[model samples]
Target: MPCDQDKLAIDDSRWQVAVAREAVIRPLINAGQLSPIDVATACRILGLRRSRLYALIEQYRSAPVTSSLAAARPGPKKGARRLAVEVEAAIEEAIRDKYLTRQKASVSTLHDHIRHLCRERGLDIPSWKAVRARVEQIDRFKLVRQREGNKAARDRLRPVPEEYRADHALQIVQIDHTRVDLFVVDTIYRLPIQRPWLTLAIDVASRIVVGFYLSLEAPSSASVALAIHHAVMPKAEWLLARGIELDWPVSGLPDIIHVDNAREFRARALARGAAEYGISLLHRPVATPHYGGHIERLIGTMMGAVHMLPGTTFSSISERGDYDPERHAVMTIEELERWLTLEIVGRYHNEVHSSLQMPPNAAWREALDRRRAPFRHPHDDQQFFYDFLPFEERSIRRDGVHIFGLRYWDDVLSPWAGRLDRQLRVKYDPRDLSCVFVEGPDGAHWPIRYADLRRPRITLGEHRLAQAALRQRGVRLTDEQLIFDTVEAQRELLETSASITKSARRQVARRARSLNAADQGAAAEVVAPGTKDEPETLPVLAVEEWS
Candidate 1:
């Protein structure tokens, strides 16, 4: 098969004929039973024998794409080296040292260089056509990057098509984050807090929402990780936990995750985790918004649904005139999440997608029917969740491994204590400081708890707030006890004032959600590794009113 089955050269007449053949046979295959007359008609149309026609039908059934029927090319097979080893090496050297440089040398110059080198080695000179073919074989992005520069390559070599294509389910999934267009209230106060951010993943082939993460906090690496974790793992248990009965069967490690060039999307944690799970990450060009058109459309569709809810902001001031979202806000963040889940699995999946021309669920099923093998899923659920989390390297001492002013100790750390040769990698969920995972030498992550077992589990946000409070009181230096005490005091204050103060209520609500996340073993509370306490400002989106 070709490396890129979806793309075919414009002048590839054989592939074009195969594509036409596929179109003629597709309906007959769909009908399942082929009569003698149908078979004879298909054989006549395709200029093939009965046996060859049956074989083509089987091939098409296994992979219902035009490329599946592509005939083997004449001459040297793909990736075959026809020239002598020394001559090929000379040609490669010439291309690398001369052609692929900022000097912008032409193919003729490269061919001449290759000829001269072949003569120097007393080898036969290859044709200019072979040299040009080798040059064309070099990746376009790499070629442009070497010859022009990174910026030019990025700007000039993006896909020109308006719609991103995927041949099967889980082939290419797009993940993106957007602030929901509704104001959700605090669970206790029943008063509006703020719009929550939603990190969503959509399968490009079927337009099915594979997974998503909703939070009151802004989008971060943690959001991306959580979203991906949800995307890759089965949703049966998750749906049952949420009391949702709808079947959301879409779950698998996507072949490629397409994303925009946001910092969270580009985080080292995400890149490393993707590599660990055998998933490819494709970042769209810097200024190419259309490259992300599929996800953007999905987001828009979701927001359009949101506009029907009680506390909807209506997407623009003009549309929201004379209406206050806060006064009408009814659902809490958790409630909003549940509502979105119902909206997705119950309605969106069943409803017809404009692009797919069929319901997403149906498209998913059809794609699955075409596949010879099942989609890939993570084997270890817990480890998959931990892999995408931001990590820190900490040295283990006699007492424990110290991080964020807290010490974590477990029997597992005993073996690696006091080792100056290397620091162990510790992965923690920012939502819970009760435990951290210390990676052992054998690549297994050991869960290490706080040295003081009695210390209550607190979120990174709460910890940061307490630290700020301590600094305000002129406590320049502090200990674990001091930090926990400050956190407890702050929580007490927030609880006490929650009924009267909106800000206090918001904080209390956020804390409750954080504790819930920690209980579910969900790591990340919008804090990326190596980032400070303050959150980055979200980019302002232009108004995209519903048509």
Candidate 2:
């Protein structure tokens, strides 16, 4: 049929595209090469683009073989010619064995390595665009694995053999806290409330949660410390029942405690407790949830299992109670602890994990058996505590010290009034970022107020500058006078503008240095640094603002 005849017969304009499409597929059909499905797919892909081709094909279909459709203008050479075999080999080799290695290969790194190899072999290469095109042609880059089974398979596979022991199972345990919302009854308000707080510790090798606790409160330092105690210390009742003597200097104190910087986990008391237990605390970077993947994954599992419980909620009146939120509960703390110990933990240890192939309990027992000698628990009454909190050496300014260009202050810092210019270590909570604990050489810590820079307010330095401007105007300012009143008045008039002449001078100096370093070409392309968001303010007493 004629292409235009078929196009006219279809009332729906979209079907007209099929005429043009069929024209493109007609040549392959005449050659008796393509399958019926393949021709349809070709027509579907070509759609409107093949309209002219379809017309030409229909014209030639009824004519002699000499009336075959003319070939179009040639585009650039594609496919095999773009990607060379040599580049493909390197990328494949890098992925085969060293994929998870420390020096794993990346796309840019692969390109660089390929270029180096070409240079060594005395081959001239094309531009980076050409190299990328060539790499894509042969599927050299390992794109994201789209299969769900792949990640689960990777997780199930162990990096090393089970028998291989770095030491005891407890030598390097991982600890983390997660909030699990539970359906519980509120005794005070007589309503259902979301109760959250679940802290857990696992032996690194076996992946067994040796200690676990849950509550309707926010997790805190004491919660983590208690969890550790439950994992290491034999229960008093268990000791009494078995008639076994409890040993001291707990056997196999974890060498490292890996945890994310949750407020509860990053507390000074938690760090001190870990240090006392002879464990090195390792905290993950702020906001990076993937670092604590194991605990996070477990949280998902617990929520799936527990939150489905029927008819129990949190007590509403309990918020005003004297009890710490970190504590599990006053009335049911022991019962909850016992239930966790018996039900979730006990069942979890006995179940065979896909990763372990054997039960977690079996794997742990085997790991313990592989230990060269028996562990003797520590009996010493005294313990050493190391301050595991992160500290940065910073110079104090005003009543506040500038950390990362933001002001932080404490009312207790009045004693250090003279040492404002001196550098001191500022210890802070990596989690919340709300309170900074100021520490001295004696290792004493005092909690200080911390405000985010995003807050709308005048900084200490700006307030001082306003006070100075007002004092110069012969205004007798009282101690309680607002500093912003004087300073903000002439803020616009005091602003300094940048000059092109100064900028040119700096550019010239930079270029000269670049020339000295034999990087003249790079220096020419360099741009000057941008101005700060807020202008630099003169030094002032931070406490003065509060006064």
Candidate 3:
């Protein structure tokens, strides 16, 4: 009808000022002290519309008006959009849909789910604060607890544990595995076999590597078994065996062994065996890496050391160039292991740690001053060894303990042998099949040798490979042919592995590296800048502030 009200009225501030000005002028106009033209002149001076002033003059005659006027920080009625009752509902739905499932439903992830729902429904989106507020309405502790269980809930929802008292070394140890970025050679041929995988354990408080194991073989439960054994058992004998003359001093059952959820780390043997010695196993929340940063850094540092070696595959392809990691590779697997050992005790442990400002060994020594608790050790080393080995339960037979079609016998088993009721647990190392240990009723480990004493020693892995190869070739392996096939299979494997190119070997190493339990990629933040088509720097802050 009339000029649109919004256009006819001045902005809210001027409108208020105009009303106030009219309020004071109206008395003069009513008193005949001033006329409409005089008020119009004042309205123009105040940048208030003359028409709005006239309109307000009429309202003032009828009702009261005030000077207080400014646009309320604009948004929705009653303030910023109350997270559309639907948006709040969406947030709860997203939390249930994402957090309640297996995927790590981090706060950001929950927010993303809500945003996606808002987009799909064509609803007005809210600020991140609004989304976060909705999320806060849910019981965070209960959410984490329900999804990940007790330990995880505490870690996620609560502050870092002050009770840990890191003044003592080995209070908590974090363990993980990495693939060395170097090609390793065979003992005889001196050809690159593969980039070896390394299992490492660090004393969390000390930032020192307490134990490590390196092998050409990929990580397995066996690898974890070896790493734990190395971590707990004294290193003096091992060092002496390797001819490494240095003090390792960092071995004992740790108070807590923090690890990630890998098959190796989650192995039943590891859990039970550790508990038997008062050590508890802890797995970090999935997709959280900073929890195990110390060991992850150690793995990175160790790999950096390997990268300096002659046959290094390097971290990425761009780092490799035309240089051949294989042809230039000179260290045998044993030699590499020795180098790693020497580097650990001789260099890393003794060198000053960047964070601690003291050598790890020195830190270990100082922590000992505050260590009031007696050092815990496994009561039986042999039993400890048996505990970690994979096992099968079977009653002793007329011959002996038969596993995977191989009969293993020992004089100790003779007492229980031929007794169908006597169910003995047989534990064997996957790396060595020469013998198996039969657990007695009293938990004694009886060494059961292969019945054919003339047969040479072979590992379970080799045996499996041989059996598989034999089957593939339409051949059957009798007990007499078992050793021969095993040896042949092993030789074939080594030769075949040795012939792989550096790039292929690097790929294998990379795959293993990606499998690291530390979630190596979790901490990285990815940002993509605009290209030539877009401005390099958008002066968002300055422009917004100026406006």
Q: How many backbone clashes does candidate 1 have?
A: 0
TM-score of each: 0.68, 0.34, 0.61
Can you write out model 3's per-residue Cα lDDT over 1-547, one digit (the tens) per residue? 0111221113434445544454454454345455766776767665667776566555544422221222233443322234567776777787778866667667777777777899999877667777665556556667677677878887776545433335687788888999888877654455665777889998877877777877656788877877887888888877897788898887777878888878788776676566444466788766777777888889888888888999999989998888899788888666887899988889998889998899988888888776766565655554555667667878788777778778877666777788646456677666556556676765455666677665655555556666776788777745646645656655555556644554434333332333331121111111111212222223323223553
Model 2 misplaced stretches (Cα beyond 4 Å): 1-168, 186-193, 236-252, 286-288, 311-336, 373-378, 381-547
Each prediction's whole-model lDDT (CA): 0.79, 0.46, 0.66
Per-residue C-alpha lDDT of model 2 across residues 357-471, encoded as one tens digit per residue: 9977777777777654344232321111113334576766665765533467755666675564446666543222334556543334455544333332333334445566667
Q: Which ten residues in a row have the lowest lDDT in candidate 3?
A: 520-529
At residue 294, candidate 3 shows an lDDT of 80
Give model 3's clash tally.
0
- On the 0 to 100 scale, the lDDT of residue 51 in model 2 is 52
Every candidate's CA RMSD: 15.3, 29.5, 30.4
Better of 1 and 3 by lDDT: 1
- Local distance difference test, candidate 1: 0.79
Q: On lDDT, who's better, 2 or 3?
A: 3
